[model samples]
Each structure stands twice: as C-alpha cells, then as structure tokens.
Target chain A: MAGSHSLLDLTAHALAEEIEAGEVSAREAAEVANTRIGEVEDEINAFVTTTPGLALERAEAVDARNGGRNLWEGVPLVVKDVLSTRGVRTTCGSRILENFEPLYDASALRNFGDDLIVVGKANCDEFAMGSSTENSAYGPTRNPWDLGRVPGGSSGGSAAAVAAGEGWWALGTDTGGSVRQPAALCGIVGLKPTYGRVSRHGLIAFASSLDVVGPMTRDVRDGALLLQAIAGHDPRDSTSANVEVPDYLTNLEDGVEGLRIGVVPELMGEGIEPGVREVAERVASGLEGAGAEVGEASLPHSGYGLPAYYIIAPAEVSSNLARFDGVRYGLRVSADGVHEMYRKTREEGFGAEAKRRIMLGAYALSSGYYDAYYAQAQKVRTRIIEDFQAAFARYDVLLSPTAPTVAFEIGEKVDDPLAMYANDICAVPANLAGIPAISVPGGLSEGLPVGVQLMSDHFTEPTLLRAARATEQVADFRYQMKP
Target chain B: MISEEQVRHVANLARLGLTDDEIEKIGGQLDAILDSIEKIRELDLADVPPTANPLDLSNVLRPDGPRPELSQEEALFQAPERVEDLFAVPRID
Candidate 1:
C-alpha cells in the first residue's frame, strides 16, 4: 500500500505477473484504481457508472484463480458502456437505456478468465452518435490534459480513464473513429481491427456493418495483448471472421525494418492542422530512420469517406436502432396507442445527435431517395475499398494523423455537426474499406498528443502491430506521463 | 433542401415524435449536413457494383439444427412491461 501509486504504471501484462508472483494482490490493484478514480473523477467524468465494490469483489475472484494462463487475469479494464456487461448498467450513453442492465456479457467479454476488475462503465456519446462525448446523456467527459478540452469521442470516457490511470485499459467500439480518435486525442494506443476481426455479439449496434469493438491501451504492446484477449470468432455474430487467431505478441516487437510504410497525403492535407501534420510527417521520418521505406500513399476516393459514411452508417443506424422501442428493455413512456408510445419513447429517449442521425438515415433510405443516397454511397464504398486495395498492394502499411487536429476545446465544434464530423476525416476510410487501423501516441503537438495511425490489409494484425510497435519505439513518448 | 414537413414525415416514419421547437432547430442542421452528403453524387457510379457488405459476404447458411438461445426468463428480464410469462403490450386501437 505504501508504494501502490507506482503499481498503476505497470501494463496489464506486467501487472498480471505481479499478481501471479504474489507481488500485488488483485484487491490491492482494484483499491488503487478506485483511489485514483476518486481523486480525479471530479475534473474528468470518465465513467457513467463506477463499480468500486464490484471491482473489489471481482478482483478477489481473480485472486482466488491463483495465476492461471490468462495474460490479463486481474487487470482493471474500463468497458465502454456500449458493450453490454451482465447485470451492470450499460447505458450506451443514452437515457433511453439509462436503467437497462444487460442479462449477459458481450461475446468478446465472455471469456473474463475467472473475472476481471470491472473498473466502471465508461461514458460515451449517446448511442455512439457524436464525435465528442458532449452528446452523452450523462455530461461530457473532459480531457484530463486540459479540463476545458474534449477527449475525441464517442469513446472519450474510455480514453480519459486510461490516460488518467482510472483503468489500465479499455474496450471501445469504432464505427467511424470512435475508439481510435479518442485514443489519439487522449495520447493512448487505440486499435480498430478489420471489420470482422473482433466479435460484435454483445456490442450494442450503432452501425452494424462498421461497428468494431477495439482495444484502447497505454502502449502498443498492451494494445496487442488486449486485442489478443478479445479477438476471436463467435457463431452468434454471423459476420465474425472465422479466421485463425494469431499470437499478437509474437511478431509485435519484430521491427518494421524492411516494411513499406506509406503516409497518406490526402489525410495530411489542407484542412488538417499544421502542427498535427508536422508530427505525423515526423513519424514517417522516425519509421524511415528505424529502417523502413516511407513514401506518400494516395487513396483517391478517401475524400468521399465522410459523405459516404454519413449515408451508409446512418442507414444502418436507422435499421439497427429500431429495436430500442419501449416494448422491451430500456425507457418506456406510456401512451394510449402503441404507435404513439413508440414515437414518444424515442423522441424523449434519444439525444439530439441520435435523432439527427436517425432522421438522416430514415430520409436516405426512404422510398424514392434510397437509390440516389444509399445506393450511391454503397458504390462509393466500393471505390474506397478499391483505392485501399491498390495502395495495400504496393505498401505493407499506411500511416496518417489519427485526427486532423489535437484535442480541441470542449464546445469548439459541438454546434457545427460538419466540423465535428470532419474530425474523423482520416479515420473513416479504414472503416469504409474494412481494414485494420491503429492510432499510436506519436508525441505531442501544441502540448497535446498527436497520433500516428497505422493501417494494414484485412486480418494482417501481426504486420499492423509490427509497424505500430516500431513507431512506439521511435516516438518514445512516455506512456506513464499523466495529465 | 428538405422542408420542415418532410422532416416531420421522416421523423414519423422513423417512429420518433419531435416537438415543433426540436423539429425547426434539427431541420436547419439536417439541411446543412444533407448538402455535404449530397457531394457523394459527384462520382460516376453507373457501372460500379454497390458494396452492401464490406467483406462482400452473402447468404452464409448454417445447417438446420437446434441452436442455443436465451431462455424465456432471461430474455424477458429487462422487459419494461411483463405480465405473467409474456411481454405485455397495450391493445392497438
């Protein structure tokens, strides 16, 4: 207990060893995390629900396991509220599901290895609708670095919690840059594996086709470890890839010596902040210095990503979200007729951002407009995929700034939906293309973290991790340095 | 640009009843966003096939068999309105 603060700095892999070796009890780790959360929860509302008591109880369960083969047996994990945890209040950051406690854990979270220290359910944008956590039914999660600034979201709380040492790592879903953007903004490692890389069985659907549950950790190595724990096939999720699960740890430290690394010129173009561009370009130089061939990579249709996503993603959203009616779980407002009840429930339950998206989706998929909007976006999606497939044929991995800019002020782009959507300009292409992409901490720009995003072809996580690990070494940004 | 009536009609179609104030405010924002989304039409997509699934997967069939499913009790645990063993709903008028 005397030197417990330093224990918080250990990665999940290292922390598990400590717990296994009897160096630190699981209970002590939970207590330490709770203490940290208590100290800093005021400035950063990272978690919508904190399970201090449950964490202690779960940690004791892990302690009883007495060091099995699990790598994260006793690690504290911040779960984004969108991923259903059995019996825990899983809000998806929407008031509609404010009191909704799931009866089961997400397939990705099913293998808890006895049990994990459930730090809390991290806050996010309502139904994962917005780019910032400001749209959370619960108030916004402020950036720990500067309380006035935003932690790029809808995974803002998860990123903030990990950065603030509230949780060792977190689970964030990336529909269109939710996980990676927040991770980059919070100066952590975020990985969005290929579309079907991770199971989406229990992840509350925002955009079924695009939603991918990903790992958000303090460093590249930990990100690899976290992804290993959750990445696998689930029969329940029809789209879940039945591919061979590789040992992410094996080729991780293997340098990107002879790998072809491409810096996407389009992502680093005009609208992107100059400071962010400098940092991203420096990452390419750093990787080049580390023995990798670095050059410009062009994804010709990349600029169409935002428009395509707004159409495609929202179309999926309207259909997937139709299940949240008052008839079942979550909020229900009583009315004379069943139709009136459904309408009123959604109107009252959803936040403004959610409503806007549902409207956009409904409008796009409407009778006559579906062909022009939805169908056109789908064709654009094919074009985007073709663009990436061509680039990947020549390059082993592609790099870009994770976000166009560093963490901006909280209220900066809230009113401007277009400006908010622009934050993911660089990230949307990866989702659209169905490829694996990562946001690794690439030092700081304007005194805040800038992320060097590495993307690779489908199911090539090993190669992706190799490039990320190499970048991690070159960046040499202190992961333990907290806000 | 979308008219307010269209916005209302879409909202109704989506099963969401919005107030006049919300409809007016959200309508203005939706117009701007749609304008940006309209830019997707600039590309010539006549010959290109649309990608409904990113992986281009279709009709993944499993052999006919009994599959594991949530028990009735488990499924209805979170139901807002339940009577006896069934999910309760008001009669449609």
Candidate 2:
C-alpha cells in the first residue's frame, strides 16, 4: 500500500493545508505515493502506466513555484486513461492504441497539472465499453474492497485508486455511468458534470454527447474541490458549454433545507434490490431530516433510456470510431490488398464487445435503417431530456440508486450482453439529457457499497454539490470501510 | 442479396480484415443484424426535419481565435512510428 503519510494519505483539502504550512514538500509526497503503488498495484492492476520519475519532477516544480496562489498544491492524483496526457502512453485500455502517446495535454489535464501531480494513468474498460474492468485488454482492475469482485468500470481503475488510497483523488470519465457506478461500487464520490460543463477536448470519444470527465474522490468535499478546478469552457472542445464556474466548495455548506428533492418512484418502487431500496429510503429520510422537501417524482421515459442509448450510442460509435481506420492511427494489419488490409486491421484490433458495438451501430445508421433506428432513437433522446427538464422544474435534483445493485462478482456478466447493458438503465438518462449527476456512498449491502445518485438539470452542479454536502454531513454510513 | 462481397466492402470501410472463416462468420452475423435493422424502413416521416441538437443550442459558435499549436515533436510523438518528419506506416499503394 502507499505510505500512510503520502499525498494519497491526505485528502486533497487536507494536503493543501499541509503544503501551505510547509509541513511537507510536494516531491516527498509524490515519492511516498510512488512507493505505495509499487507495493499494491500489481495485485489490483489499477494502473496502466506509472510515471513516478516525471511525477516527482513535476512535484519539485510545483514546490518551487509555491507562491501559495493556487488553492490546491502538493496534491497527487491520477488521470483516467481515456483523457489524453501529453508524453504519456494513453491506451484507452485497448491494444489498438497500446503504444499510442498523446502529443498534447488535454485542457483538463493541463488545468490539473497546475495544482495537482499526475501520478499515472488509471486502467479502464477497453474503449470504455463494459461495466467491469474485465473488458480492459491489459487486464481487469480488481476491486480494492474485494479482490475477487469488480470495481465497476470504464473508470473502474480511477475509482479503485481513490478507494484504495492510491491517490488523494482522480479524474474519471462518465459515459453511461462509468464514473458514478464505479464510485458507488467502491464507496467513494464521483460526479458527472453537466454534459458540456467540463470540456471533452482531451478525452477519447465513447458516446461524444454523453461522455463527461469528472472527479472521483474519498469524500464529497474533495470531489467538489476537484470539480472546481476542471469544470469550465475550453475553446478546443466544440461541445464545451460557456457557463459560469461556481466555487463548488464554498457553496457546499448551504443546507438542503426547503430544497425540493424528488425521489424517482420507478427506481425506488421495483426491480431494485431490497438492499438498494432500503438505502434509497434511508437517503430520502436523510434528506427530509436535513429540512429538504422530499417527494416522489415520475419519469416514465426513463424506462426507455437503455434501449435508446444502445441504439444511439452505437450509431454514434459507428461514425466516431471510423477515424480509427488503420491509415491515420492505431494498429494496422497487412493483408492481400489495401481493402483486405483495412478489413483485417479492424477485425483484429477490436475486442468482441467493440466489434459488437460497431456492427450494431453501423446497421442502425445504415441507409435503409436510419429512419427507424437512429432517427427514432433521437426522438426518444429528445423525450428523455424533456422528462428530466420537467422534473427539474418541480425539484432541484432527482434522486435514485446509481445502479440497480452493488458490485457483482467479476466475470459474472461478461458473457451476457443484455444483462451488461441493463447495468446502465438508471444512469443513461442523465447522459442523454446533458445534465449533472453525482453518485455518493449511501451504505453497505452484503459488505459491498451502495450508491445514492443526485441528478440535476444542465449546469446545476452547484445545487447538486449543495445537496451532496448535506448528505455527507448526515448520512448514517461512515467514510472509512472496515478491513 | 447481401453477399460476402458486400460484407467485405463494409468491413473494409470499418478497417477490419477477416480471414476466410471469420469473414463467413461475420457475414452471417451482419446479415442477421441488418435484417433486424430493416424494421426501421417501416417508419414514414414525411415532414420531420432531421434533428442534431436535442437541447436546442442552435447558435453554438465559437469565436474564431488563435490557439497554441502543439510542438512538432509532440504531434509526431503520437505516431506509432515516425521517420524524417513523417509517420511511417505500411504503404497502402
């Protein structure tokens, strides 16, 4: 494990305090964190690449420039592999780009570099596809809580690193619950900022419209702090929204009293595990105890989110991933002819799930089927967005269980495609509608963590953070898990 | 009839090379997938304008301004193999 006094040992907020006080140098903390990863990372497979030497150098520079102007300095963190990091091997958890190194730092990573040390790139689901890190071409990232189970995925390794105290906090991409679901499973806090609230310039495209980069941390305050640093407009990313960036940490003390919190009736009522339902009830009671007006809210279109996402995501996948053609980038295979070369390259480069998505997507957006599948899915996407907007009109944020269940055994759903897709049933709507959502640890179920998700309309992260802080203060669960 | 030839065309478009046996396997899978997609053809929308932005951000335009450029070394570093200021890859021609 990482040293007890490493940067990973102190919370981002606490580490800043120590750094400002000159109690520890940034380089010393980076070295301690590096030593810890050397001990436990092999067993957990949480990192794809570790750059301790570069991390220490960066730490030294941050220490030298310690004008104490930046709110956070001397904090170490991990960058999700999905975001491009200059000079680092950013594989996106696929063999196709296993050797690919980014030429430029993603704007978000650049911002992170200003105050935090990038310890390494965390492992993830291959192309961010599967619910479990089992989909990674390198290997599955074992849950820190239970080595036998999954850490929930795409951003599984990011969540695992924070859960295991590998880093103070980490950046993770949430496309269809990649960040929130894993954070839920690992008993941490993860936020999926409003679709365009955080720039996507550096992150690899999964479902471009749905993908968001956000913070994964041990506490809600750390999550809010990290969000403040990375949430803003970037000219490089066309999808990035021009919105006011709020001081998330400052406004977090605002209590949820008199705030309208909606409990999604469908999520609480059925198909949810008894344990999850119990936690949801507890969360509502907790909100009510905090002086928030809690009531049931219905979103009927939520039922169709998964089906629509499956169709829409792949259709976009078919087009977005087309750029991976061997000629421009990624693995290229030699064949009898040019056409055969292209054919062989993709077939061999992509994993089974990737292939499945590409084919499904191509068929959905094909000439004859476009109107029926892609077109209809778009309309459904519109309705889902409308449903959330109508609900936000009635409530400050919508509350539900992030996932239907807690972390399941690794390899349990690897072979079942439909069951794997169903995992994102509740989380997909927030993505489709371009809104902010966060998953905070609610309680434990069968020795695993259950998550309570808070979702709000676009650019409502301030309100969401306010609600999250209140929950953190009053939730019956403890932050530290029993070993 | 969507033949193996048509399958090869699409596969080539997607940059996947399939062996003879794999081609046959994927061809069958594509046929089934395509048959299912044929259901979309039944929808008749005479007047619905094709939509892109569901959230209605119609005037989403960025101010045309200069941005920093990636150094040549950084840009070239992303290539799997580069030589003499050019990305090195097997010649398609």
Which candidate gets the maximum TM-score versus the true structure?
Answer: 1
Model 1 interface RMSD, one decimal: 1.0
- Provide per-model DockQ scores: 0.84, 0.31
For every model shown, what is its TM-score relative to the native structure?
A: 0.98, 0.91
What are the per-residue Cα lDDT tens digits for candidate 1 across A362-392? 9999999999999999999999999998999
Least well predicted 10-residue stretch by lDDT in candidate 1 chain A: A1-10
Question: Quick one: best DockQ, which candidate?
Answer: 1
- Each model's iRMS: 1.0, 3.6
Judging by lDDT against the true structure, name the best candidate: 1
Model 2 agreement with the true structure over B1-93: per-residue lDDT tens digits: 467876666555555555777667666755654454453344444454443543456666777888778667766655655786887665565
Worst 10 residues of 2 chain A by lDDT: A1-10
Chain A TM-score of model 2 comes to 0.97
